[model samples]
Target: MTGTTRYLPPGRLSRAINRVVAALTRRGLSLWGSRILSVAGRTTGIMRSTPVNVLAFDDEQYLVAARGNTQWVRNLRAVGRGKLAVGRREQWFTAVEVLDDTRLPVLRAYLRRWSWEVGAFFDGVTADASDDELRAAADKHPVFRIVPTSTPEDRG
Candidate 1:
């Protein structure tokens, strides 16, 4: 919780699984509520994508980095915006990183929803974890509030 953030890069097998999931999500198929997150690389300016679980809470959507301080996190920090695609549906949105103190509920909700898939990244914390435990782990995970950007279609 109050210790260093944990970062576990995808292994070769994990990368391959992600690629497959991304392909499906891009083509309009969401595997267990997944989306392909596309953001521009900070250094190269090229589009980078990875599969992510989108969390909806209290009429607000969020993107949580379960793995902690990942490439997408850095990229989002740089650009403050990105696109999420599921199938042919795409949404552009600006991101605001949630503050550390406010991240507990979001983190708890995320674990409750996605722990089956990403629980290992949270050290031993579970969705049933106490508030204090969750607060402690807040520094390791980054949560972003998603604000949809106005697009031409929406404007018209």
Candidate 2:
């Protein structure tokens, strides 16, 4: 569970849930701090979007790829920026990857907040897992600090 290359593709249920979540966020609803994450596709250059949970910790926001190196994670790493949208509001931001060594706290906090939804991907790791355990699981999950570059703007 400590490899950056690991990725567990979404199952049918997961995919369906993502679509519903994205739709909800687009309609001005947030299901547990969810938002629509839009990023230019590394290959197509067209914006591809998916639903994501925004983790607020230590007064900063972070995006953690709990399912491992999924498409959106790879795209964000390649582009280094993207837009987060909730209904008509869009915020542009640049992302910086968090190194594996420093991910313990964020990983623990994120798990504490999202374990019900994303826990399977982390195997048996939990919010109360030892620092070493969480650290070992960190590399399998890519984390990015969201540095917003634009004020939230009205889409209209």
Candidate 3:
């Protein structure tokens, strides 16, 4: 969980693209369920924002990092909570890391939806992969279910 997870750092092009997507999403334009995820830094406690794709399954919303154990994922783990914003709407939620065995459905659904954008980070594992394969990849990619809370960040 510490040194084993794979992380794909965004390059200049990806950063620029993320900036655009984050800006648009902040203004209420969600491109294919995209949202700006804001979480506090693990050490600095400063807020960091990044674009993420939300997966909805079984009446619950989830945040899955295609790139394993990313900064946002680590930060959220440290803080235990985060905010998801789309346009002017902000929703605060508690994040609970899904265990390896329970992550298959969400991981599979996420790939099926956003694989074109993040498939490369999964080491060739697509939505079509077998459940065992997805489960194997779960250790690298962390999945968190977003449990909405009536917190200060909530704008609804």
Candidate 4:
């Protein structure tokens, strides 16, 4: 109920659901299998591109940050800026790590709104976590939010 428990990675069932949904949505998709793509630079200030399944999006985008300490996250941190492309839409936003322990409550609130996606990750487990613990793990893996600069390109 606390510590890493709150911040645990997606459970098997949830992962399965995500996999299925991704496959279905991605059928015949051309760009990247994952609608959410994380692009970072290879060299300093250069842009490196990688596609990722967007866990959820809010006023800020939510990424699982599962592959902790991976090169993409490292590169994003180095540049402090990047682009997240979803479908035919693209946006440039400044990346920032949310570390405030107080933000866990808010994070939980946000995740609840994304229950379909977030719940699947937890295999429909009661997505419960204390602000303190969620904050701690978030600090470890850290959900990087691309604070939107302008309205996401009109999808309509």
Backbone clashes in model 2: 0
For TM-score, the strongest prediction is: 2
Model 4: residues with Cα > 4 Å off, grouped in runs: 1-34, 42-46, 53-58, 106-126, 150-156
State residue 54's C-alpha deviation in candidate 3, in Å. Answer: 0.9
lDDT of the structure predicted as candidate 3: 0.87
- Cα TM-score per model: 0.90, 0.92, 0.92, 0.54
Local error of candidate 3 at residue 113 (angstroms): 0.3
Writing each residue's lDDT as its tens digit, candidate 1 over 19-106 gives 9998888889898779999999999989999999999888899998988988899889888889889988888898989977677888
- Please give the distance, in angstroms, between residue 140's alpha carbon in candidate 2 and its true position after superposition: 0.4
* CA lDDT scores, all candidates in order: 0.85, 0.89, 0.87, 0.52
- Over 4 Å off in model 3, which ranges? 1-3, 152-156
Worst 10 residues of 1 by lDDT: 1-10
- Write the residue-wise lDDT of candidate 4 on 1-39 in tens digits: 112323344569756865665454445342322553445
Question: Which one is best on lDDT?
Answer: 2
Between candidates 1 and 2, name the one with more favorable TM-score.
Answer: 2
Q: On a 0 to 1 TM-score scale, where does candidate 4 land against the true structure?
A: 0.54
